[model samples]
Target: MSLIEIILVGIGLSMDAVAVSMSNGMVYGTLPRRKWPLAPLFFGLFQGLMPLLGFFTGTLFAKYIDCYAELLILLILGFIGGKMIYDGFKGDKEKAEERVLSLKLIFFQAVATSIDAFAVGIGFCAINVNIFFASSLIAATTFILSSLSFCIGRKFGDLLGNKAEIFGGTILVILAIKAIL
Candidate 1:
């Protein structure tokens, strides 16, 4: 994949993390500045790591699924993006605010958000892309977007509110469609 494509994929993959970060910001808007590092650190680490895991898995099984790799990427991206959009519009907004940022919660959120990147790693094998560069770009983009999401949520909590999730979801779905086309 070209650098632009890789970056687009990263942005698409980071939507979930962004939404989650926004939710965190809304809930913990009053948290002390000292604790700020925890959220981004945990988020960035997982966002970066998951794609590497996926890449290794893809490398192991590359020979078996080489022909269908593009289709697989489209399917995975579409599904993830569609799901995010659906969840954004349909999920319980009240519960989102109530969610606590415990270790277990963070871990689950990280894993859930990063699963698509794992699939993307599998796609990378088919396209003969540099896994290190692609994965790094994905992780870095996710980190920046997620961190910004938190700030946006905190600043516009009352006005943007739950609508941010809807916007994020829309972005994911659009990217997925673009990937397929």
Candidate 2:
């Protein structure tokens, strides 16, 4: 694929990651400055890594992965989104500033969001694209977009207060449904 095509593909693949990063921002509203990059980095790394893995795996597991990718994404994002909604309604009343997002959660989100990219990588093999360059572009796009979305969500979170979680959770659930559709 050409550079423009790869970049476009990167943007397309990064959408889910961006949405999840935004959700994380809202949910973890007062996350420390040092930790701000955590979500984006994890997301970018996974987004990049999955494609390379898929490229290397080639056609071996393509059918299996394609068959189940949507279902897996649904379950992962659904569970997390449901939890966020439940927490929002439960009114735990913990200060947003006191909350810290767990690495496990970030890891799951990253994987869940990058499954489609894996499929794209398999397609890349068919097209004889440069896997490294495409994956790197994808990673960079995800990082930049996700970072911006997170910052935007943080501002909205401050304005929305407890409602932020509910909104963010809804976004994830919707994205999950969109994936299935």
Using lDDT, give the best candidate's number: 2
- Judged by TM-score, which candidate is best? 2
Instruction: State the displacement of the C-alpha of residue 175, model 1, in Å, after optimal TM-score superposition.
Output: 15
* Cα lDDT, model 1, residue 56: 84
Model 1, range 1-181, lDDT digits (tens) per residue? 7999988988888876787677556555555677655666666777778777777886675455544544554555455446555655766866556544567656655765665666677776677888888888888888888888887766764565566455544554554455446
* Cα-based lDDT at residue 32, candidate 1: 61
Estimate, for each residue in 1-181, the C-alpha lDDT of model 2 and write its tens digit.
7999988998999999999988988889688899999999999999999999999998999999999999999999999998888878876776544556889999999999999999988888888788999999999999999999999999988888998988899999998888799
TM-score of candidate 2 on Cα atoms, chains taken together: 0.96
TM-score for all predictions?
Answer: 0.64, 0.96
Q: What is the lDDT of residue 112 in candidate 1?
A: 57
Off by over 4 Å in 2: 95-98
Question: Model 2 — which ten-residue stretch has the worst lDDT?
Answer: 91-100
